[model samples]
Target chain A: MDAKRLTLFAGHYGSGKTNIALNWAYRLRDEGRAVTVADLDIVNPYFRTKDAEDDLARRGIGLIVSEYANSNVDLPALPSQIYSLVDDRSTYGVLDIGGDDRGALALGRWVPSIIAEDDYDMLFVVNKARPLTRTVEDTLEVYAEVEAACGLPFTGIVNNTNLGPETTAQTVLASMEYAESVARATGLPLKMTCVDKRLINDFAGQVDSLFPLDILELYYMQKEGM
Target chain B: MGEKVLMKGNEAMAEAAILAGCRHYFGYPITPQTEVAAYMAKKMPKIGGTFLQAESEIAAINMVYGVASTGKPAMTSSSSPGISLKAEGISYLAGADLPGLIVNVQRGGPGLGGIQPSQSDYFFATRGPGHGDFHVLVFAPASVQEMADLTGKAFHLAWKYRMPAMLLADGTLGQMMEPVELPEPHDAFGTDNPWATTGTNMEREHNIVNSLYLSPEELERKNIERFERYKQVEAEECLWEEYLMDDAEICVVSYGITARISKNAIAEARKEGIKVGMIRPITLWPFPNKALAAAADKVDSFLSVELNMGQMVEDIKLAIDCKKPVDFCGRVGGMIPTPDEVLDHIRALAEGGR
Candidate 1:
């Protein structure tokens, strides 16, 4: 897979953008590249990239997030450090934009610099499992809303459909047609299909551009063997 | 049961409410629970339902009151501070013997507290939501599945008892994602409600839905009648889940997100040879006094784990009739106690430490 200098993920709420962005950053880091991941999510009050700050730091990856990221204050304050994502061309930058048009509005401010560089891939991550985006038409509506809000055309589509921890190999396989339909409608390349790392063995020679992810253990406090 | 789907707790509850025949949703957005309002705003209109983003929390709840009076299942959701603003309307719903669903996805609070998960609103919900001698039914869900399942149950029980009900959740449960088998959709509005203020086709007397009583004697009578129904609720509807309670000596009590954390602690404690178990209260208002009372006779001591500063400890003591030594372990103001912290507390209790 060809890696871009700037990889941005944006989609509907709870569409697995944060997980994808984090995994993408880790992949870049593993390739011996200088990677920095930014949390551009201002709409959501929880479950942002900052939640994995220590993990990112341990991997020797840079993180640029809001000052009020994990605070009680739910202000739409973007940190000034985001400027470095564009200014520092030497480092690879991956961004997890917030959900929907309101969340994508934050990307509008950085559009000029990003467009001028022309070295980025803005991927529209779609999840067929989310009730609102189950259909091809619905997914495109969200795609158009996000693109218009951020003032950037999506360069590719990523199929990230899954049922949380219950996601199976069949779930990813079944979502292929939906993902292809979305890509065909938008006239964008189907860059990748995200599969749970546990289910990667099931997709052996059948799938292309498969990005395997270790599912984010969000509910680690939950009792085991339940 | 339908195929399982992944959803955040907030979104699960909103979708569950819709499936349970709720056609009207009135709410103002607040953190940890705004997804409820957002989900409703997008889907309600497409499904021929009413979704109104009222001017304020107070207005939103009053709007729920208006819809519920028509014998239709109506709902409103908010976080800690917003729920406080809706207190008056909640009390009115109880006083008028009207059934409605109120969801409080709690964040830390006294005044505009942080947007982190906390069980600080336990007293606010279990006691009375508004100014009156009444109790609203409260269901605390620990997982995304329960968030959806209890939503349907809350609506059923609220209408069955003709009282307001609350799905009390914390920030962690509201924000976290998990797989859930959603309930099948049903039309709750079509049910026959003899007490509803629906227009009588001149064939029967007009039903008047109200809470105001002019005479003190009449007001006292109404209050007593409401208590009678609450008594029936206590007898028949108390819900709780017991984990590894058999042959246990040290019992742990918790609800909502804290219960999930406590379960992890209990599992570790068991591995280390501690006989600790957990009794998770699904129904907070009913309180599951009988289960605790039964366990109190066997357990040497009790630990009340909470996300607030000992709000539920008082109820734990009352439930067990103060029979055993009840210890309080908690975190307040948006901080959650880790499993290690709870395990450490359990370790201390097993070692005879306070």
Candidate 2:
């Protein structure tokens, strides 16, 4: 796993950013590192980092959630605990931000303190299967909008391409050229590529860095064994 | 055949329309369905087509009316509230007997509702979308691939019947992504429409497109003729799908995303040795009465699963003539019933518990 003191995950709503954040937090906890995840998503209601609070707690990870998280209320109350987590240098902090410019404002509130600390990586996760980010130009445009809104530069890119449960090994492999095109245009390093663990064998000796996904969303859905 | 590529349902609908010879599009941005207009804005110019972002849904529908009267293929799309605003213009198009397409990627509604998927607009789409004694064909697609195929079907049917057709999809179908094989692009709208409102040019008789009639007798005559045409459509264009319906005790009736969810529930029920099946209506306006009536003869009962509060159940009941008890399982306000919940409903009905 790529280790950083402060890492930010930002993407479009259905780009699977929450799952990537959860995976990173779980991986860090598995390695016996102090991990803290802050749910900075207030725009979308269906999927969020707070949904895995119990699993996160079982692994000895701390979670910072809004007062009105997972409800219909529009109030954004990111508590002060998030500030201390960012300040704590010994712990790894992952912020799962929401999609679009309006959602990036949640991250803007912490930009001053984040720049003051000066050791962070904001990764713009791209799903080539998504409508708006299918092309290199469209993905760059979305990246620029989020950058302008949150006042942060995306240090790297992660090609986390999938079609929900219908994802296949071919789907992830087909995005390699597209991801390369995006990396070439933006001059950002290709940080990693994420895919379901079932397809890890197909990607052997292919990608530079591979993050095997555990299908957290489907696990939650079928948890009751229905 | 175009190569298979993954696409969102909304963008696929726009690409399908372009492939079906739709050169003119007028739409306003709304949640869950805005991708359709955005895709058109990007692709239409490259293909030498017209993509206009109208000021409002009403203006977009009126623009569709204008282009349609000129015998050109045109379309517009919106969500629930925006669709409600296009009601008057839809009535005008139907009254004038013009061919066009309208797409409704429905979100929750009654007012400016939430942005999640909902199927609450069944009654509005199938019964009285516009005003008075008019029928607009409605096709419901359950997947990203169907989203493209059905939009192409809608354009063809619109021209065949010289009437407005609707692709009634919900937010889940609009936002979800899947692999699809797109159709080949059509050349142009045929130039043989005699009733088109093209300038006379002194070589042919003058053509006029109007829905107004001063005499009540003439208006009544037009309405009767349109009803006759609708009867012909009902006889021919009622499309539906039956899944594992052979030798089943209960049938689950659904369409669009809800139907996709129901298939999962049906498979679960089958594992427990309960013979459950499905009848998915591809055309909602025709309502697939013949298929439902036929299923009523073999199935013990029916459970209509929807993302709305029992809207399509009334049509099912009427179709079967209340021969078998019809029950409803639904969720409202953008809430979707899980596959386990739907399976529980099926079990209850099979056990004569509902």
Candidate 3:
């Protein structure tokens, strides 16, 4: 399947959705596609797409963020430039949403425009390692929460399971069963499976599309002096 | 003791609070401190504990007062702005002599400040949390592990002294992730206190929980009694860490997140053959005076490095009775001083003094 003209990534917090969305935006920009990565994350102050705005701008990808991003204010100020990307059909727009239902409420505002104008795909990125979505039933509950909040049906599942630095091929491969269960429960396609670039060769034929993880920045602070 | 698990400072404090037998948590959400409430919300229900997200910070601390009135371990957490709102309730809790834990994951602020980490609240926390002659036993945590450890200790100390205690952390400590070995859940200390306002059904004399004393002499006596307890806390509960102070010529004093940076600066300065050390105060209220005073007798000079504009330096000077030249190096308004910046201060202190 080709990349949808408009794509939104939504999932639970700490589900590795932001990294997946960032990797996808860079892929489109590198391929000479007109891309705009909108940071619709207002829930978490840390690990938002807005942190990488300068890097995205240099690569010719438009980055939209909250007016209060990187400042300490909790109040969100979404820019009017966001609607321009949604109205433009030529641009491959990727909305990196905040975690869970509270974050999905932000996406609800642009629902009418999203449905009326563009052929969009809202992919629910799943990571089994996160706390709330460890079990099959728990995964279904998270999907339902996001769906109910966003008022948009998820189009597919993008399995992006890992335990940060401890992740190996086994870590990525072992999540296949859990990801398949989520796809079956939601009646959605398992569109892609993400693995770090180092292990792409091992998982070529196993998944539908192997998304190589080109992680540019890791902002998670480790223990001091470790 | 359990296996060390990688966790955020906010979540670690939540776990440690639960492990400390604190079953009641009432808090309003604020930036750089919301995760503590989120973690409590997720875990408190499953464990059959009360996790009420109050309508406002004022209501949250009042809820804390209610739970603490029952002689049960209760807690409320917030950042800078929210803590300001909870000031009235905190004073009420202190005046009533209610034992509870108040976690302040401090952000930069005088009013609606930025969400980045800051130690600017040193004056607000230690000097006077609210009106009247009162002090919340403030413990400043520098690491995720201390975030967990001090939470448990704060609860125990709050109960031990029958006074309000605070775990004063900054945004960096609250948001940062590190491995922590969580303490075992202590048994609940509920309704066992002799002076608790549990209804007396002809069991004994009625116990009242309040701060009201109509007579002038009675109020003075109550104030004197509280000070006596404070004196004991100062004697027994002053906790600090002196890193490389044995042969140090320049003593760097800091606490909380700033202390972490100072420790690194001390190491860097030592690498260059500069005799630098640090005194990281785990407890901010007692001020760790004796240790700094002793160090003053030997060290050539002192440098107070903090996230605020030299608030704690005044205390450092008073602690040593102005014997040594205590210089100040710090950043304000959410800016963190780099190790190099602090190291430069250490070098300057070394060169300017004997």
Candidate 4:
């Protein structure tokens, strides 16, 4: 994977960054694009990149993580191989970074390569219901904070404010509207609005990007389309 | 007029689901988490949504499985023990890569623990409640407002990754009240979950969601493959909160209710001529280990405080893996320690047992 073909999903806690990354990765891979996933999360355990090991491997996707060590103590830092992999990348590669502005700060180390080579989409996942992020200005402030911390500019916003089982079409639409406002304020493109495939037909024409989540499904779509 | 009142974590989650366009809710009632079901029960029908009070926690989870399998945004809520009951279903969701949300309004304990606020569920949500090789996207909320807001992201992430997502909150956070600016309502009849079992008459083949992988080779490959997706998640999705860690002598690590207490403790310690800092992890799953590690390089020592038996403390030890002493102190079974208590712990740890 050329560092030039980089895909990043980033944002604060509860901002849907992982969700966007997972969906995007599946879509690209499904289109017969070779993808390798390296689980760089040494932070939170619940949803680490290691969590999706099974599904991605079944589709012949490459998976790498800290478990290479038997101590089960890998929490920080990435192998120099990651840099080499980025430097040598040919197809598409997606990286799901941990949340928090500080975590993004690590990206600064790779900014030179990231900016120079990658036509990457640094997607900002936003959940309006999250504290410290409920308004367009709130998102802009966070975007700035992340930009300064990571030393990389974000390219788009993914409106992702929805309630769990209680989430309704109303809530999804509201979230998208808020996302649009944030995108306008931040001048970041509103890349996509993720709606449950269950809500597919209802929201097909409503947003700019129809992120048909369910990673494997998109993989199938991509492969089938190709 | 609809009330624009300050609400607790439970109420906010319920209300946010509505605004996010959820129409079906299946859950069993449990303390410190009843507000979620209560709100759904009271409102789901009026808004033409579905809310079912299942016979047991397991049943509630399975019901959610049935609904979520159709590709709809479905959810269920329970305290620690009850969440344990639903572990099987959570595992299935992960195995099937189903997109769904599970709210864990944590109470105390390894077993029928207290209904009071506690962070004991940290490992359970971070790992899993069942004996399985699986994980969920866990979002830890420090306040009621965050609990409400993260609900949407949970569902969105669940769908995006084709896995289960969790909103891990403590009793204090779930019960606390706070002001919130609600989002706009989605057009209900305008939803688009084609994969949802909204009924597949002549459209396409039926969708089946299951996690029972009989083939060892298949399951092994599945495990490796899921790790691939997780890799992508870690690279781009981890999250956390940093407070005054720049050039500090020692750092205090905490989350949820304890995070609030830790913050206050830091303030007091600062006033007393101590340079203690804080790093609150917003996304517990993406534990913000890198930031903690970096800060550890600049600090003298680290102190970890939680409401459990020093559960998350292990994460701190692993993250920083520093030469400095990584001390820990906490109260369990819903016993919330005061900020002074945390300050005392910090001072004790900082003084190096002198």
List runs of model 1 lying over 4 Å from the truth: A218-226, B188-190
Model 1 interface DockQ: 0.68
Q: On a 0 to 100 scale, what is the lDDT of residue A202 in model 4?
A: 75
TM-score, candidate 1, is 0.97
Model 2 lDDT tens row, B1-354: 765666878889999899888989999988768778978987799789999999999999999999999999999999899999999999999999998899999988779877778899999999858998898999999988999998888888888888999999998788766678788887435667888888888899888788999999999999999999999999999899999999888999999988978899999999999999999999998889989999999999999999898999999999999999899998888778889899999999878832
Q: A-chain TM-score per prediction?
A: 0.96, 0.94, 0.93, 0.84
Give the TM-scores of the predictions, in the order they appear.
0.97, 0.88, 0.89, 0.59
lDDT pick, better of 3 and 4: 3
Please give, for every candidate in the order listed, the TM-score of chain B alone compared with the true chain B: 0.98, 0.98, 0.98, 0.92
| Share of true Cα-Cα contacts across chains kept by each model | 0.81, 0.14, 0.23, 0.00
- Model 2 is docked with a DockQ of 0.25
Q: Chain A TM-score of model 2 versus the true structure?
A: 0.94
Worst 10 residues of 4 chain B by lDDT: B186-195
DockQ scores for all the models shown? 0.68, 0.25, 0.29, 0.01
**Scored by Cα lDDT, where does model 2 land?**
0.86
- Report the candidate with higher DockQ, 1 versus 4: 1
Q: Model 1: per-residue lDDT, tens digit, A108-220?
A: 98999999999999999999888789899999999999999999889999999999768888988999999999999999999999999988999877888999997665334
Give the better candidate number (2 or 4) by DockQ: 2
Candidate 2 lDDT tens digits, A112-141: 888898889998899988766878988888
Candidate 3: which stretches are off by over 4 Å?
Answer: A112-119, A126-139, A158-226, B1-6, B179-181, B188-191
On lDDT, the candidate that comes out on top is: 1
Q: Write the per-residue lDDT of candidate 3 for residues B202-223, one digit (tens) a residue.
A: 9899888888889999989988
Residue lDDT tens for model 3, A1-226: 3888988999876677777888899988888899999888878876577767777888998888877877766676677888888887889999988888888888888988998865988999988765457788877888898889989889999998876555678877888999999999889999888888877777658766788997545342332341
